[model samples]
Target: MRFGVAFLGAAMMAGSGIAHAALPAGFTVTIEDAGVKSASGAYFGGDINNYGVETFDSLSTGVHSTYASTFGGSPISGTYSNLNVHKADQYGGAGGNNNYAVAGISQTGSYAIDFTTENGESLTYFGYWLSALDPGNVLEFYKKDGSGGFNLLGTFNPTDVIAKVGNNASGTNPYYGNPDGTFVGQNKDEPYAFVNFFNETTGFDRIVFKQTVASAGYESDNHTVGWWKSQGGNEVPGVPEPATWAMLIAGFGMIGGAMRSRKRISVSLA
Candidate 1:
């Protein structure tokens, strides 16, 4: 084969392998501020194939939405049904109806959540969550290492968000705090909360969100986990799902069969 054709084939093969997913390493998960009616349209994780976000509005009020989606309603393929969706927002109101965010629960105190991808994913550093209250409430992040040890990434009081982030309210960088916080702002008071963090360099299988210890459960608005995606200029390519592998194999097989049949016809003509 000519060098040009060989190079084109290799490029084409590489293009076929690109898939939808966050990069496992050196990826940044950014969480922006949310309010009753947030005008700012943004995402914490990577781009979605549908709906852009995995909002559990399909769930009931004050109930955990059990699904294998990243956040919205997209389904995770195959037996890799580890991605679960949980939402605590009970004040369910449509966008611009009552100026309410599909998320943002009035539940008081603290709430927690834990997620573990099948093979475990490499994370940049840590993650953050949103809530309705902040004063006296706390949110903590932890990652389970390969040795089966749970390491505390960091503890954040929404009240301290403004002080820490100061002005960075909406950047890809981890420290770009949430200024539109509805929870206890840096442990300040109600209607003023923000539980967000940033990356450092760590590989964690499981991520745990420990709500600030209190009498009641806190309203968990969101959890931001930043992973890089190959389609989005990922440093490393992602592995294809089982179904994708089958399709690729079938496509190549058909091409091979067609080529062999064409050669047979050519010999008969000659």
Candidate 2:
């Protein structure tokens, strides 16, 4: 078989150059300020290599919004670019949880979001670009109520995201993989980021995510936040059942009783 030196060189150059694109274009993103209301922190983790950033070209598909907050709600729109996305990996002797380590970008601390939807309802999904697969970790989603209350929506295992990144391949020095539960340093299989219920009816907006840490001999803890936009308006799915209202009223009654008892105790003490 005849080998072409020129073709080899060209291929190498192309592969090398794939990662060196300019930062993402300008965007005026909204992020909430601290002390307003926030759920958990969002993390954006990734690493840059000789080839360039380990980004999935399809990662930013569809219309999505990003936000940041300390407690929850209180959102603000801001700008996000390729430069600001967090990317981290194991380097040097620093080793704790290989999969335990995750890079995070926040909509908080000057973070928020805005997105568009054509239909009456819009769906927001969550994910990230996996430089490597970490089955030990899971992605959690939280939803915030109007008065700054939070509820855990669901948790996603790496298995759910495996399909999206399977075809993605990385040309960088280090590689990342998209295989279900496989972690390789340089695969371009970027995972999707989302919140299952950010529709108009919910009247709820904003989202955040963090990486889970688990290792046999070592334990790791990490958190991060991501932002999303609401279709905007007073609408959502699923009606609150009569039982739901009963529970809510009963809960309030309990609180009221507690308050009255506290007052009586204060008087007795005086």
Candidate 3:
């Protein structure tokens, strides 16, 4: 890929402190379990997860994406040129009930950062703007401790905001093409979510997101969300354990003492 030399330089300068860290090297945002009913096309809901190694580049030139639904399957990856990002507040139809082929840039390719604390812990912090959605659409946060379970941080519902809507408007549902000649649901606008994380003490490696399907029907509610990672970013520093640091410090101290004594003896002999 083509990278601007100046930008890369700036990225390194900003991320110099963590150059030797063992933290994540990048970040990824993904939507999971996202879809509405294939028949009624009512309310839609799914999970959005932004996980991956923490990096400085992600905070600078990361990418955000929303894919057309494939019904109940994973989002199909697309070419970089084919990816489109839009503002979230530009969509969401009239009264917050619509479905059409929607896509846009959420956060304008900005930074969503995660970091490791001094205690050898990891935390994620992200920020972004969005529009177009029902008055009740919500985004929930979660974290995994390398265990089999997930912890819910909280829920962020877009109030007085906008969101992207997916519909089968033109009858050409790329995700779920109609058997006859008419699509059921079409995605409308693009909604973006920016996330931030911190307090990475346990060094966990997974994150999950879930959207609540409120009162809207099963088909055309709050669903259809996906994300892609922007390559390269700042790396979180890996702080050695207290014991490890102590050992290294002690070893260095011994070496320093030996060198000083040798210099004194050599001077006396001369």
lDDT of 1 by residue, 1-270 (tens): 001223323432343332222233333323333433221122233344311232334433332332333543322211112122232222122221221212212232222334444334544333333433322234444567558676665444332333322222122323222234242122111222223233445644444333322222233433334342321111112344544543332222222211110010111100
lDDT, each prediction: 0.31, 0.24, 0.25
The prediction achieving the highest lDDT against the true structure is: 1
- By TM-score, the best candidate is 1
> Mind giving the per-residue lDDT tens digits that candidate 3 earns over 67-171?
222223332211111122211112322123332221212212111112223333333333222222322233334455457555544443322111111222343
Candidate 1, lDDT over the whole model: 0.31
What's the candidate order when arranged by decreasing lDDT? 1, 3, 2
TM-score for candidate 2: 0.28
**Order of models, best TM-score first:** 1, 2, 3
Worst 10 residues of 2 by lDDT: 261-270
Error of 3 at 108 (Å): 23
| Higher-TM-score candidate of 2 and 3 | 2
Segments in model 2 whose C-alpha atoms lie over 4 Å from true places:
1-127, 163-206, 215-270
Report the Cα lDDT for candidate 2: 0.24
Clashes in each model (backbone N, CA, C under 3 Å)? 30, 65, 71
